[model samples]
Target: MLCCFALSLVACATVPHTGRKQLNFVSDKQLNSIGAKAYSEILKREPVSENKTLNETVKRVADRIGKVADETDKPGFEWDVRLIDQDIPNAFCLPGGKIIVYKGILPYAKTEAGLAAIIGHEVAHAVARHGAERLSQQMALQGVGAVGSEIFKSTDGKLDEKTRAIIGALGFGATIGVILPYSRTHEFEADRIGQTYMASAGYEPEEAVKLWSRMSAIKKPPIPPWLSTHPADQDRVNKLIESSPDAQKKYQEVRDKIGLGVQLDVLMDQSDRQ
Candidate 1:
């Protein structure tokens, strides 16, 4: 059974953000549930920000970026944005269109443009389906461990609490630890998409570079991006500079169309349906 499963693992998988090809053991359905579950748990643990102004700010900026994710071919997402009152300078979007932004990131994301960068990055994660993708990779790695008991074949056995916990933990580590930091490639890809999204939403494309410069400077204790799996500050800054022209053009086009039509409303409504 292990040998058969090993053979089957050779087939292709898609990296969420980059849409690059890779091997994945976790099924799309499985990964999605993992994200949905984790997101549900997170929402329960964290308090939703009731600051009406801040919530509106997050929603407005997130809405604009969502409208601008065309280049990413963003699947219709339930565009609900919540500002959680936590000081963890982090934000993330789950596979099922759930987005959470912690209060700590507010300072780093000063202006709306700065916030756009962060939103763009997180939304890029959802667009690329990075959470699901990472979870799938983890399931595959877990498969290697399962080789001992041929446990994967015994679906009933594998679903036991202990086994399920191990698998769940693997998926979590992939998303939070490995995938989050190691997501530079995903980050770079998200950066491109986010930049375009922000630009299309009337924010300057050049702001991404500036945002990263400040972001880079904020490492009270510095760590290597590649080694840590986060993006390299210099690399991100350089790419933003290189792509600003295209981003700027996209922004102009988006600006002209902003408030000119009701297409985005249709999108938001559709998100509710899904």
Candidate 2:
């Protein structure tokens, strides 16, 4: 057991740019295979957008940001992007770089730069292997709990009610104290890394802050950050503001800055439907 722990410590991975250490026992091949299967199933169920404008916009933004991510992380991901005709403001990049952008998010995106920020953030999650890191965390926690159960097993070979209750309480505490906070950390890390990606991709990093501002305006009532898997909207915006100067420096270094690119027109889609 000690040797296994020692090997795990030696095998820890470091996140590029952020330099954060990650404990991911899950192999990239395994995670990416699962992600590919899931992405295929999701695409089969979701109505992929046939709108040429939307498809072009999503694909373009994803391509630019994906290139930057590839250069930065060398994750060897096979990047693909699709625009889904959904009414929810959602976007996600699964492992191996499969990105899905929902139509409802176009209103929030506002411009090409805004879309870049969103795609950059999701791609950051993928390149950083946040999904695998999270799964590793869960596996480790469950293993610890299982070990504890065996160690504390009663003479009758079962945990007493009190011991079971104690284990459950510890599980809840770990969820609240470790898992929730780690999820929020992943989000904040993605936000920071995403700014670098957009800036390096020739999109203004400030658009990320603006994108969050627009989304927050419509956000529902807040929950305390400690109890939630995501940071409060205001807190996220503040951190972005704090991180913008460095991102700006990266943007300035790009020889062919695209600035904000083209403005998005969700109204046109609405009109077509009418």
Candidate 3:
């Protein structure tokens, strides 16, 4: 009881999505391993992009976006960006520099700023370690704190799906927790933080709003997986625009310091070439 009480107050976390202090009971290592394993399994099941043009576009865009983080004081993030030649328009960043962009997002991204919006958002999720934080919260919510510790211990450095499922079972009370609840709060957090990341990456924060506008337009037939998990697009876009005044100003000020309209132009130029 005393340990649980201490854990509750001592775990002061600054949410990457909102810059707010939140109670995070999950360990960073556990989060990374889970992301890594999930990413690996997904890759094995689906063919990753072998397209040269796609690869070049994603890398160029990723480089530009990653730089914005340094300008905004987000340091020490080892970044690796790759493009996957899938039909789905989606992207995600795993803890410790793993990132993937699908070709489907290209049509919607249209420009470097748009790509920045997507990558920045994914990176925010990783930097904030939201996945792990959610698992920690899940354990607390269930009053099974020991499961949280087990998750941390078993799913670090290197992990497989079986290990992931085991950890998920303990903390989440079901292997399907990750698939079922899908952590809606975490998605919201990533959106807020992703907006900041894009701004820092030298993209207009409003472009995130625009990107979501495109997302809102996604076709109804197949109903892509990203849409299913991502919150209501219009509402998210509105929040971004409402928050844009401050974020856009910061981006403008940064660009002016370097003498340009969004240093992201270079990446756009690179992507256009590809």
Predicted structure with the largest TM-score when compared to the true one? 2
Error of 3 at 174 (Å): 17
> How far in Å is the alpha carbon of 244 misplaced in model 1?
1.4
Candidate 3 residue pairs in backbone clash? 49-85, 68-200, 68-201
| Model 2 stretches with alpha carbons more than 4 Å out | 1-7, 144-182, 221-232, 255-259, 266-274
Model 3, span 1-274: residue lDDT tens: 3333556666657764367665566666555555555556556656777666556667866786677655554645667776776667566676655677777767667676778787877776667765556555555666644432233343334545544544443222121224322355666666777777667656677878888888887767665545554544677777777878877877886665543223334443555677
Candidate 1 is scored at a TM of 0.71
The Cα local distance difference test for each model comes to 0.61, 0.71, 0.61
- Residue 17 in candidate 1, Cα distance off native in Å: 8.9
Model with the higher lDDT, candidate 1 or 2: 2
> Considering lDDT, which of the candidate structures 2 and 3 is the better prediction for this target?
2
| Structural similarity to truth (TM-score) of each candidate | 0.71, 0.77, 0.73
Task: Write down the RMSD of candidate 2 (Cα, Å).
Answer: 8.7
